[model samples]
Target chain A: MQASEFSRWTEENAVYAVPKTIIRVGQGERSTAIEGAVTEDFLIRTLKDLIEQGR
Target chain B: MSPLSDRDRQTLREMFRDLKYPVHLQLFVEDGNQGSDNAKVLVREVVRVMPDLLRLDVFERSRDSLLAALYGVWEVPTLILCDQKREDSGIRFIGLPSGYEFAALIEALLDVSQNRIRLSEKSLNFIRNVEDDIILDVFVAPT
Candidate 1:
């Protein structure tokens, strides 16, 4: 996800708060982690990066 | 008579001995409540395992009003997790912490005792930047 997409989505949604930290734990094929403290900016950035990665 | 069998009680007693911080399990029972007996039994079983971090404090309502209000316990079998410093973070369980929720209860207890939640780097980054007060209320069933 690119930075811009992350910003736009978070700004538009009021109910969904962006996470302060987005940790992708684990490694290789079976990696998993949890997101915490969602703030406005973090949500936008995360979404953008996700979209860019096509995830 | 204790609800737990002799074997189970012994195992619990050993588990609690290894804890680094003290734990308290305050069980609030209302007269004639359906699960009061069950709750008491569960507390006894838990105390037997982690006696160091686990304590069973029973409140009969008539004993003290201030204690109930302090814990915000309106119902029976409420579990409040406190840190090592004796600070209450306001994390509460309204019903029995069994089943999938039991895992959550264990994790929360560990977090309070250790003062840390193991997360990935990316997740940690997001969490560290959060300035706002975030209230996470997770609901689950005992079964």
Candidate 2:
């Protein structure tokens, strides 16, 4: 969502920067937030690790 | 007034000149909202530059509840990228894509049009082996 459009959402999520990504797997069972610009490799690794941690 | 400048329009036309497939932009908007209206304007301007490669459909969220639900859109001013056949490409923008986000929107359009994914080999493998429905909410400021 546009953080600028929703003050409440931005405050609740603590979106103090641009490109704050929240990744969720399987109906919100597991989720993680990554701040700043991330590379494709980093994102892929994080996803794999998050899934592994849930196992 | 057009949201895009003449130079920006020319650049977009050039960028999309090599598009091999048509991309559909499905925009879900709320009535009487400034942000939604701005989003509509920007998307319309972008599409106008490359009509041959882009198709746009605007849906009022309140009036098109079923269509919104079908596309899993729960927010106003959300833009979904789809194929020529109206298949979802799993790319979406949940607000007005201004500032830096506009560049991302353009990149997504290009990728969607070509059905291209520039991922690493390992990342590609991970995606291919994925068996779960994933939802990624990338929150961003316009600037």
Q: Pick by TM-score: which candidate is best?
A: 2
Least accurate stretch of 10 residues (summed lDDT) in model 2 chain B? B134-143
**Can you write out model 1's per-residue Cα lDDT over A1-55, one digit (the tens) per residue?**
1226434744543224333233322222222222444565654465444433433
For each candidate, the DockQ is: 0.04, 0.60
Model 2: fnat (fraction of native contacts): 0.87
iRMS, candidate 1, in Å: value is: 14.3
lDDT of each: 0.57, 0.87
Give the per-residue lDDT of model 1 (tens digit) for B1-143: 65557885675455434466766656677666656666666666666567667666787754656888887777666767766666774567666665555556666666666666555677668667654333332122234
lDDT of 1 at B91: 68
Highest lDDT: give the candidate number: 2
Lowest lDDT 10-residue stretch of candidate 1 chain B: B133-142
Docking quality (DockQ) of candidate 2: 0.60
Q: List ranges where model 2 is wrong by over 4 Å.
A: A1-22, A27-37, B137-143
